[model samples]
Target: MNQDKRQILAQYEKSMTWVESLADVTEEQWRTPIEVGKWSVAEVIGHLIPWDEFVVSKRIPLLFTEDSLPKAPNVQEMNANAANSSRLQSKEETIGKFLNGRHQLIDALHHLTDEQWQHSFHIGESELTLYRYFSGLVEHDWHHFLQIEKVLK
Candidate 1:
């Protein structure tokens, strides 16, 4: 694999380890919001599960194909439901779900050929390469990771 793909895959692998470590944190720390009126650490991690599933099941199959990409999901509803689920579940359960979903995404991405990484596809009116798409997701992961880390500290 190229450096870019390696980097993305490494981030995915690193995320699993990072989240697994959160299982050891105190419940109060796990549930603390990163900022006033924002999502708690658990909720922030919880929200990632469905997004990974969406990328694996919905986004990957349609990309680089003749078929049109599906419409975007309702962000508010999906996020609210995920956050609620996180709030109701144990920290271990929430982290387990996140790890499972992320593993599935990593597996799907591993199957893609190097050629596909560079292939451009249109999402609605915007065109982007698979590498770019995954790169954006990695950036999203870092954004949340920082939020959780801040709250933990």
Candidate 2:
């Protein structure tokens, strides 16, 4: 409900508007791999799930239960794993899962207090507040959304 959290939620809402508005594309379109080379729409959606899940279900809880940020996996390695994940899913299933995870992220952001938003955590060598993490999520959404749009074209 603070300004930072409000801004993050607004950004997410806007992004979701685009994500949710995408419709009528054939399954072939969704399964078409593009952008990050081997990543299809299904894989992109699959990739986003753990990120949203991490922010909502993992990081937030760690803010209270643990004294520090949880150990993060290597970014390059994780992307490699996503690329290799054979469970690419159907268009409907991928989109539905993304929507569900996105809603959970929004709900989690809505509940954060001002202090929590200001709390600092380190990712690699960079220190970030909760708001920064929210911004990162927004960036992540847009990055993949553009990839999806480009592939559809």
Best by TM-score: 1
lDDT of 1 by residue, 2-65 (tens): 6667778998999999989998999999889999999999899999988998999999988978
TM-scores for every predicted model = 0.96, 0.81
Q: Model 1: runs farther than 4 Å from truth?
A: none
Off by over 4 Å in 2: 64-66, 74-88
lDDT of 1: 0.90
lDDT of each: 0.90, 0.73
Total colliding residue pairs, candidate 2 = 0
lDDT of 2: 0.73
Name every residue pair that clashes in candidate 1.
Answer: none
